[model samples]
Target: MQIAIDGPAGAGKSTIAKQIAKTLNITYLDTGAMYRAITKGVIDRKIDFADQKAIAQYAASAVITFKGQRVFLDGEEVTEGIRTPEVSEHTSEVAPIPEVRKVLVQQQQRIAEGTDVIMDGRDIGSTVLPNADYKFYLDAAVSERAKRRYEELQEKGGLNGKTLTDIEADIARRDYNDSHRAVDPLVCCDDAVRIDTTHMTIPEVVACVIDHVEDGTAK
Candidate 1:
C-alpha cells in the first residue's frame, strides 16, 4: 500500500502524511527531509550551490534514514539539525538539480518497494511514485501556509529573526521554483485527489484524506 502525497512547503504535507500513516499502520517517509538532509550536508561541507556536480556527488553518497520522526545522516541523528532555517533556505536550490533528484528518488523507491509506506514531497505522486496505490495533492493559499510556518517557528523558538512577511515571500519563491524546475517539478498528478486546505483544520483535512482512501479501498 503505497501512498504519495505531493505539496509545496507548509501545506501540511508532513503533518497529514504522518497522521494518515499512523491511522493506517503504514511507514511514513518524509521525502522532503531527505532532500533537506542533502542540503544540510552541502551547507555543512561549504559546497557552493552553483556547483551542481559537487552537490550531486555528495547526494549520491549521502546515507539518509528515518527512525520514527527523526532523520539520520551517515549514522548520526540530524532531525533538528536539518530543520534549521539555513537548511530550509537551501533545500529548494538543492532539490531541483536533476542529478540529486535521481539519486534520492532511487533511494526512496527502494525503501517503498514492498513496505506499506506513505511518502510526501513536491513530486512524489508525479515522479517518485507514479504508480502508487493512492496519490493526493494538498495545497493552501500562500498567506495561510506562511502563517502556519510562522506559528511553527515561533513555537520552536527558531524564527532566526525572520518576520511573517519574510516567510511568506520565501514560500512564494519556493512555489515558483518547485513548479518551474525543468526536471520533475512539483505537479498535481492526473489521478491525484486535490485538496484545498486553506480553510480546513488538520483533523478536517485528515478525515477528508481518510475518506478518499476508504472509498478507494472499498472500490
Candidate 2:
C-alpha cells in the first residue's frame, strides 16, 4: 500500500508518518528532506537563489539518498546539515523551481513503484502520489505549529539562538510560499482525509491514521 501525507511544515506529518510506517511495516519517505538537501547544495556552492538556471542544474544532478532516517547529498551524509536554519530558510526558494521539482518528483515516484511506502511532503498527495492507496492532510493552527517548531529547535539546542517569535515568522512565510508556489502548491486532495492536529498528541494522531489503515477506509 502507498500512503501520502501532506501539509504545511511543522504539522507533525513527518513524525506521524514515521510511526505509521513502522506500525504498518512499510518504508517512510521524507520528501521535504530531499528539497532541503538540494538547498544545502545550493548554499554550499554559493549559488545565488536568483540564479534559477544554476539552481535547477545543481538540483537535477544532485544525488540524494535516504537510509532509514539518514539523508545524504552527493556522497556525504547531510542528515544534520540539511536541518540547519540556513538550508531551511532557502528551501522554499529552491523547491518551487520547475526543474528542481521535476527531478525530485521522478526520483520520489521511482522509490514508491513496488513497495509499501508512506511519503510526506507539501505536494505528495496533490502531485507526487495522487493515486496513492491512502491520502491524509495533517494541519494545525499557525500559532500551534509555530510552538511545535520552537520546541523542536530548543531540543536541538537553545532554539539555535533564536526565539519563538522568530520561528513563528518563519513558519508563516513558508506557509505562504508553499501555498502560492507556481508548481504543485501545498493543498489537500479532495479525497484526502483532513486531520486538524492543533490539539492532538502525536500518539493520538498515529492511532487515528492506523485506524483508517486497518479499517479498510484507506484502501
> What TM-score would each prediction reach against the true structure?
0.97, 0.97
Top candidate by lDDT: 1
Q: Check candidate 2 and list the clashing pairs.
A: none
Model 1, span 16-54: residue lDDT tens? 999999999999999999999999999989999999999
> Candidate 2 residues 139-205, lDDT tens each?
9999999999998888887466788888889899999999999899999889888999999999999
Error of 2 at 39 (Å): 0.4
Candidate 2: residue 124 Cα off by (Å): 0.6
Whole-model lDDT for model 1 versus the true structure? Answer: 0.93
Model 1: runs farther than 4 Å from truth? 217-219
Candidate 1: lDDT of 32? 90
In order, candidate lDDTs are: 0.93, 0.92
